[model samples]
Target: MFAGAAPLAAQFPSDSSEPLAHARELLRETPLVDGHNDLPWRVRELAAGDFDSLDIAVHQDSLHTDIPRLREGLVGAQFFVSYVPADLIGNGAARFALMQMDLIRRMVERYPETFVFVTTADGIESAHEAGKIAALTGLEGGHAIEGSLDVLRTFYDLGARYMTLTHWASHAWADAATDEPRHNGLSPFGELVVREMNRLGMLVDLSHVSDSTMMDAMRISEAPVIYSHSSARALDNHPRNVPDPILRRLSENDGIVMVNYSPTFISQEVRDWAVTRDSLVDSLRQAFTIVDVTAPDSMVVDTAGLRQAVAGWTETNPAPRAHLEQVADHIDHLAQVAGIDHVGFGSDYDGIDAIPQGLEDVSTFPAIVAELLRRGYSDEDVRKLLGQNFLRVLRGAEAVAERLQQEMDPIVATIPP
Candidate 1:
């Protein structure tokens, strides 16, 4: 249906690698839906939310994503993230989330020829058939709701298909993977949030939550949950990655864990190197404190000196580079533990600073497809990884929502002050 668009098979020349040519052919037939991307946040940070300032229609050297690269990647659909900082919990977080959501909407409006705003599994397919990319939105933190089910409902109405329960810090009702456990898991209100999300056909994303929180949400959610952007913890031991136990439970819960491409999450060596570097930087900061600290307990360090010290240390001890093979290893591990139907991709592109070697930008997705093919993955299995798995989960949530809406009322419970 794409007039003047090159035929799928003709996109690759005869000189292209056999696996790469095959990978591109497979992607054209199947919608390669990425679970998470932070282009909206990148635009907010770099362009002050002005699409004109950083036009994505052409190549953008400064960012990992743009329309040209996404087309090169053959990405059929993408979940544009409306990520609010964890610190915004009580201080107008809901408003900030609204602004981010509005930015996504504006993006669709501005690039109507290239993007089709989609909220359902079928919508993605429709967009793909029309040779346009489907643009969907996902909230990156539960803190964006500010502990209110009403706000959660409003976000779903605004087209948020999923929400990570927490970011780097634990909030009022949920524990974060990177923070001290306050709620242990989901608090009473957090459980209610999951239930309400199920009823609304919105996905319960467990990417940044603690293990306890993952277990709690998995046990409570009627709809299948998703790790919008995470890797396998069994491989790297990063708190941000999913453990084998959770991966095992995915089949029973009928959930999917979209493997992440972040270097720290994919490679154990890289993660360890980061930890040591951070410790060294912290020690260096202790010796060069700022003269005027505004907060009594805060120790502000001279950033210039810290940067120089870290640069020197990095020069001496270069960090290990994670590669495409390591990413495939994570995907292979997830499929081994969680089953093939539950494995998918959520590259965390534009959200992370460091990326795996070959998977440097959005255009590199075909390289992953080629890697998996070389590893003996059947085209059918690779198709599932590309987008079928996520489509199944999306439809599953929609089915559950249809059933729940007929039986239950909207949750109005609020967290007690």
Candidate 2:
């Protein structure tokens, strides 16, 4: 997005006097509290839930995340994602969700020296003070609850502090950003879900929900909501990105939008290319051996054929490129529309295969902060963007939870057909 910006690693000077260096120093103090990272799901995919297969305690070139890389990035805390393929909605979503949570808990248990399990905002701070990476859990889709309030509460009790209302597909209660509007917005059950989330102190995530769903949840939620891994739609017009109006509404609701680093969500050209590619994949599904990729967990296609075909399509239609500056651009747009207090980092790492040009892995966060410095963002504002805004939102949710448990009754009402 910067006309001809240098590589991310080169953006900052090694010298301590430079502003970039100053930004790095600030990160050392507060550290980046990333809203989302999908290393757990990546482990599930690669090792079939075998925790011993991957040694994250050391550097893992296979992953976008590793201890060395996270330390280099100065990531103080992370919300490790428990993402199940949306197609598992009716089949084994709840079970899958539990398995993913179990994996995260096991990961923390295995690497106690590197990761400290954190559930509350206070715990996050305490872990940081103790010089450990605070590990928190977040469920990626509402389907993980299987439309049961009891299930939702159980997930909360299991250390999941936030749950995105939808993923790439719609569920019984909420609509997804990428799916055709089935509920138009939050169905009656969806509204009940939001209210229950508020009472339970769980942060209601709106990243994959449709705009109307976002509005509906914002209207009913007593606590602040979060766009855990979304960018600005006004910049790229992708459904997965948040619209400017919603950013405005976010400010009023006292929430934050963690900018997504996914190339399609950040670049209009890439989004356009993706639309065409998806159509081709659909056609392939019809012509060749079936693999309901729409339901990733259940996909049973000609893997060799589909992979080769998709690779060919990519070769023919080159995917558009995106850079960290564009990432900064989205951050700037969010701050401009929603105010600086409402913007933060939520890179969907490991969850996505494509990386923006300059943002290769966890180690590259300094370059992003350095670019923000080049854009003349004050050090304080940059710090807030890095992690403070998210921390504030976390603390706010804790306070809301306390007030809610005392002031309000849990919604046990169900949606009527």
Candidate 3:
């Protein structure tokens, strides 16, 4: 966006500091936290490797996340999602969920000097003060509980802080953005889930819910909610993006929607191109019938890979920095629609195939801060977007949980005579 202003050599003159030196300094001052990332699940999937030797290169070998990379980005806390695909939830999902959680806990326990497990806002603060990356867990889909509150409570007892009501598949309790519209919104049982979440002190995440379902959640939830990872529907009109009306409601209720970093959710052009690529792949598959892709063993069809392939695909066919700017555009839109306080960063690392340009992984996050600073955001405002807004929501969630738990005598009655 800062185009033709000055020559590169002039901007980074040997006689003077880099033009962005101040921005870089401020970035270090900011406490970076991401709302959702599936790195733990990915790590679990590849039990094929050693986790102890994980560094930036090994982390980025497959996707976004690794200890060294997180330190480079100054990421203070991360809500590593124990995400299991919806269909896998019933038979193996629950066990996988437990394994993923234990993996995260073990990771922190082994690296006590580099990481700390945090369950509360205060804990996050203390861990940050101790110079460690505070790790938190959020169940990406409600189905992980297997349609039982007992299991939900057990997950919470295991350090799960929040749960998205539904995933791509609709559950008995709620509809997903990708579901076939059985209930149109939350079911009666879904409302009960909301109340249960309220009583349990866990945040209800609306990232993958439909528009009607988002409103339903905001209306019924006793605590302020979060969209763990979503973008602006106004920009791309994808089901994954939230509309302004819902954004306004999130703002009113003091909730936060962590902006996602998926390229398909950012630009219609990228989405269209992805469609074209898929069609091409289909044609080739029909013609040859030997492995879906000919581009070696690692030919990812998603936009991120397509952007940088053997043909120099996305790299040669660059979708302007404006496509990336649209990320900030959503930030601006949310500030206008939901108030500046309600928007935060929730990059879908390890979960999505394509990342928007300029935001490939954890280390590139300072680039986002630099972009925001370039757009005239003050240092204070940037800090909130980075982590403070989410911490505030967590504090409010704690209060709401305490108040709501008082009204549920059954959970307390289970304490025995």
Winner by lDDT: 1
> How do all the candidates rank in terms of lDDT, highest first?
1, 2, 3
Residue 170 lDDT in candidate 1: 93
What is candidate 1's lDDT per residue for 308-410, written digit by digit as tens?
9899999999999999999999998999889999999999999999988999899999999987776667777888999999999999999999999999999
**Candidate that scores best on TM-score:** 1
- The better candidate by TM-score, 1 or 2, is 1
Segments in model 1 whose C-alpha atoms lie over 4 Å from true places: 1-16, 293-300
Q: Is candidate 2 or candidate 3 better by lDDT?
A: 2
The residue-level lDDT of candidate 2 at 386 comes to 80
Q: Candidate 3, TM-score vs. the true structure?
A: 0.83
Candidate 2: worst-modelled 10 consecutive residues by lDDT: 1-10
TM-score of each: 0.94, 0.90, 0.83
Relative to the true structure, candidate 2 has a C-alpha RMSD (angstroms) of 5.1
lDDT of 3 by residue, 245-346 (tens): 888788667899898888887776776676776675565544443333656654343544333342454456554333457787778777777887888999
Decide which is better by TM-score, 1 or 3. 1
Candidates in order have lDDT scores of: 0.92, 0.86, 0.76
Model 3: how large is the Cα RMSD against the reference? 7.0
